[model samples]
Target: MELGVGWTLKPVGFEDEEDGQDAKKIVDNQFEKMDYHGTIMELGMFYRVLGRACQVNTYDLNGDFYFNKNEKVTGADSINPMTITDASLRKVMADRTGTEPYVQRVTGSVGNPGTVELEQDRVIYITNNPFAKYSTYGNSDLNNSVTDLRTLARFPHYRDALARLYSQMHRIVTIDSENSYNIIW
Candidate 1:
């Protein structure tokens, strides 16, 4: 299957001149015209965590969580747990030549807003209020007014994936002292 679009792999620090030369060749040969397929994958993680925040804000705006409210409210609710069967997150690995199956979804609230507990298998995709603004009310009043606004937390697996991607990017560009380097595959 087509694993989305390709990404440009830029070379960084290299100890050997030959490694730098190789990296330039690789860029010219493969990655020069590649596209990273938008930031959707990254946003996916953000969306899952902040979905509840959206719901909560919707409720505040519409009075009811389902309707559109007048106030600048923010929050979210459980809209059924997200599931990732086999082959959920498929993509071209950082090696730029291989494909890999990665975790797409995680159970439970990737982020939550309310202090009330959530149900099992029913994860809160969005839990924080990103729209919380300053009010003229006193600190205590402001605290109470904006008590619901919170930042969504990231999923552990998603966090891991981000870290791995960063590491891979860093690894691919490293140059050896011998001036010869192997492209990570």
Candidate 2:
């Protein structure tokens, strides 16, 4: 089954540009901005799931108290940094015949391998299960569900939240960078 993840950002306040001189200061400030934004997005996703299961406010869904004051307001504290040590993406894969499930595979090819290439550098297949089949009714229901969810999750809310959180980070960059700041989920 596919899992749902949701995310949001918190408001961030930064010092004025007049107090800038050192490159270290600028880099540090930028890093702080990234950490804050990343954390909030992560925490928001976590809270979305927890709030649904426990029927509580998203803000109050933090069970480990990882989001106390002094912790980065962003959701980074919700996850263990070590879990994402490598830049590679991670996912779960289930075993079809056996009860044992395993983490998904990670592989990349040096060049294009056509339909019948056998001597590939890296070949990884984490599962043997066939893809899930969807009936026409199921497909329609899924489409409607997605449409309803997206409608409920207004784009303006995410935009406004991010705008408020990284107001200073946004100012430091150019218009092109600002355009790039737009994140969907």
TM-score for each prediction? 0.19, 0.19
lDDT (Cα, tens digit) per residue for candidate 1, span 35-77: 1132223333334442311111122344533322243221232
lDDT of 1 at 7: 38
Relative to the true structure, candidate 2 has a C-alpha RMSD (angstroms) of 19.1
Best by lDDT: 1
TM-score of 2: 0.19
Considering only N, C-alpha and C atoms within 3 Å, which residue pairs clash in candidate 2? Answer: 11-165, 12-165, 39-74, 39-75, 39-76, 40-74, 40-75
Q: Write the per-residue lDDT of candidate 2 for residues 1-185, one digit (tens) a residue.
A: 01133222223443644444454466456446546444445444443432211011113354421233464333223342222212121211222333332222223375643222211112112111134321111122133245535654776456565546545443432223434554432
Error of 2 at 21 (Å): 8.4
